[model samples]
Target: MKNIQFFFLVLNVLIITSCKGSGIPIDTETDINIEISTGSTVNIKIWNFRIDKDTTLLNFPKTLLGTYHFIKNKVNDFTAFNSKGEKLNIKTIGNKFVIYGSGDLNSITYNVNCSDKTSINLVSSGVIVDKDLIVLNNNILFGDFIGENRNYKVEIKKGTNFNNISNQQVYHKNDSIDIIRFRDYKQMINSPIIYSRISTNDTFFIGSTKFVLSVHSPNSMVKASLLSTILKPVTSAIINKIGFVFKDNYNLTFIYDEGLNEKVYQKIALEHPNSSVYHFFSTPSFINKRDSINYYQDLQQMVAHELFHVFTPINFRDNFDDCFYNDTLKMSPHLWLYEGFVEYYSLKILLDAGIIDKDYFFSKLAEKIYNYSKYVKMGYKISLAEASENIYDKSNLNIFYDRAAVLCFLMDIEVAELSQGKYSLYSVIKQIYKQNNKFNKDSLFFKMNSIAPGIDNFANKYIISDKYPDLSFYLSKAGLSYTMIHKEFGYYFPIKIIAYNSKTQTITIEFQENISPFVKNKQIEITEINNYKVSSYSFSFLYRRYYNQEIAFEIKYIEKGVLQSATIKPILVNVPKIPYYPNIFINRNMNFSQKRIYEKLFEK
Candidate 1:
């Protein structure tokens, strides 16, 4: 009876083996198949080889992104199993694991125990595989990680329904999961997919290259339309004037955060024009339903700034060494060319487009100048070139942007003067663009020397060398001057107040501190600045101007219910100032002759 039972068991095993598909054997030559599930589990299938002679291991990378300097190897929670479903012995080798095969094994399988329920957070850039390494080259502003000659394949898991992804093949299995595939690393790095519930439409262009907007936020359509309309003309102008022949295509993407308000979006859009892609987050604090006009205007400015990158350093980089790299942090030294020139054009494009009047443009320039003065006073001023080289240091990032713009303004004036009212920085850039080659620090230096041999020394001393130039001297050459104004004895009061509403039409005293006897029982109202009746609603505007300055104010204070008047002077407060062209319209008119000269040099 026992022999009969054994025979039956062997016969059943043979039948089960026949029913299975072509299975992988151990201790034979074959390829390995790894199946990674979204649930954080991995299945390994071996073919034609025996499991007894093969080993499997799972591991993690040693470094994270951005920091770039730190390196460490640590991995855990790994296990292996055999065809019989028996657990195998495992040993750790740094971040990897070593598994012992039963005998001449041809197949193996292992599982990686991850704590996260989703696989999104596990995705990373800058991967190192054994002797192979992958790095994204950042020298060309719009360049991608994959080179033109290389080709590879990537397959994303399905069922996670991430939508509106461009330049990628996506497969959907359900609402929560999807799979994406890329032909190579270049495609993956150059194209960044933003997944959000908010939906919006956008317009994009680089010469004949047109992009339709794909956003998740529904409320962003209007703003996206505005951006599309504004950028169309500007991009057309750039392409018409300068043909696109380089490998880098200036590809960029804009991602709007439905939670971000108009003001914050405007700030980000204006500031980060050259970013490969901008993700604008809309939070409760940034957007409000009541201020649609302001919101629209802010969106226009954001679009203008972002689109401007196509013409500036993005297309006309300073040189190869100045380019960005993953391993090192450095700044580009051609701030006068990059930011300053870009700022000048951003304003010019808006003016030429008739989006803003001449007066508004000049007012903005004045604001910049006032802001520049604060940085100058702080003894932290540097030339545009120096600022560019040190820009990514984080310790001085903020100062570089504003300061570089100021230097560009000065250089524009210098170019205008040198060419006898005939040439400007615009002409110089156009010349470089016509050359149709990548820029490097050495090439830029050589070009500057070629244009104005003596100017190189001047640049070395005032712009390139490690010293702050006397900005006042340069402004004087352009018939401008910087003066410090003081007001300390006009009238005295101990209260700080502001109007509660525009309807009030009158300033209201809000707080009093260390009250003086002369104004203790007095009701005071601000009526004028330098004899102009101060609009109560415009008090905030005035405050912005007087951020670090003391000024004389004509006040109407009520002493015991009786109206009184006094002129009070407050101490000057120190604040940072950005350089501005106080008379941009006049400057443009005066410099119009230079445009003709530039036309002569490059127009033909």
Candidate 2:
């Protein structure tokens, strides 16, 4: 979910009065007015508010205390009208609006409209009246404004049903809907509500928190069910280990196309059974085909990846402020700890859960190894820290997820080898959680580094440093080998090729490799290499470094007609041999111990 910002404004006026009970003259009487506006086409719901004012003067909030920015003034398009139907020009100075003189303000009203049409972004609209007075039931989503646990009376213009409303305890009386309570403001913001006719709805009871799944389409039902199922076991595992659970009460909503297929949802369900998934399919001619197996696999992988978030980083962490959502300053150094470590566990969990077979798991691991090899080959290799900091950006998203996954695989194997199969990446994460009071990035790294002595150096060399580390050595340690192949072709020219430099009158014959017997006596002239046009003279210069086998060129010389031409086939040569990892299991080693581990992890 994206971060959102909220704004608040306060108007103040001063008046003098005599205190009857406490004697003496006291500046007691003060009048203040407040208004909030929303510029959204979608109905805006503000279920929490906090405001306090006294007789002496109106004291407004200087800032949304826990929020990172100053947004009081940006809550614009407001007007203060008097009882006589006259407009009152108001100027905002800092947090308070100066209302000239002291007078009893009768009432306050506001009209909040949606200003932007670029899809409903929650934070850009929706303002909780008297935000400071509102008690935060959960964590803050975007800015610092928290939701109050108290009931709120919401009056919407007639004829519009509330769509994507969070915390389902809202009741309708007369023309107003009374919002009863909220689980957490922060969680509410993370779960955005989009209004559409078709949606996937699922309900689950997790202790006191009622988990609701609302998606945009019926096809999302399978995915939602799968997410719910996966999370249930993981959640049960955590509960069994510890006496508590995180994210106690929450709604997991997903918005996607309206016409998505059921098979897509089923694949997602197969992948993630613990998460509440939702989607809206927008197309009608949705077809199921065999080629879609890869697509299903990818979707299931994504579901498992997301559902794992519930326990791994969400519940256990080092620093809260340095979180990716709130503290941008501290996020860079901890990206690897959060994304990389989490990625490692996601794959492990899938393997352990028995969703994938042992051979398939190793094959996936091999693919990671291969991809990491390519990333190393590239000049600009990124460390976990660099990848984390730039992960959200389009340029780094792929590397962050892929490279981190590969590193996790290597590190998992390293841990497994070091502990002689007693400890794995799971142990490392569990240890991190146990050591840190709060689940955060910094603490996780600290714990991980403590267990693995050279972890920092490993991170620096392979992750942070520009120098590429040879992965072949590490991979070979796990009983793997690397290979590279090269091939060459021979050409023969009968006639001596001449290069006439029109600018500098030079003559040269391009170098032709070992001559073939058939064309030895025929006059041949090289005109191009790999489709790149070159003069007969420049062919010698172009042939030296052009090692690729897939080379194409045209040979032009007088034959049957004026300018006869023949196309040359590109030479086919083998490059480096990457490990062939199978995606499915047909023939692979599977023993009792491996089967036991897989069953214990997945419980399937």
- Candidate 2 lands at a TM-score of 0.53
Candidate 2, lDDT over the whole model: 0.40
lDDT of 2 by residue, 438-503 (tens): 754434444666876545555566556655555554443344434432334332232345444322
Q: Which candidate has the top score in TM-score?
A: 1
Residue 229 alpha-carbon offset, candidate 1, angstroms? 3.8
| Residue range with the least summed lDDT across 10 consecutive positions in model 1 | 6-15
For residues 1-604, what per-residue lDDT tens digits would candidate 1 score against the true structure? 0011110000000001111144432222333233322332323343332322344333332322211122232222444555566666877655445667634333344333322211111122211111111111111111121112223222222112234423334455446444444343334343443343334556566655655544333343335465566556655554444454333333334543332222222223321112234444431122122233344455554555555665665566754332122334454566555656676556655655566665665555555666766776777746556666655554554443455566666666666566565556666767767786467665675675566444566567656665655766666556444553443322223445644332223455633433332444344554433333333223333333333445455556444566567655543323223222344333234245445443332233
Instruction: Tell me the TM-score of model 1.
Output: 0.54
Model 1 bad stretches (over 4 Å):
1-150, 157-162, 165-187, 202-207, 218-223, 230-254, 258-276, 283-298, 318-331, 381-384, 452-454, 466-604
lDDT of each: 0.43, 0.40
Candidate 2 ranges beyond 4 A from true positions:
1-180, 183-188, 194-196, 204-211, 218-250, 258-286, 289-296, 322-332, 359-374, 390-393, 439-444, 464-469, 480-604
Model 2: weakest 10-residue lDDT segment is 130-139
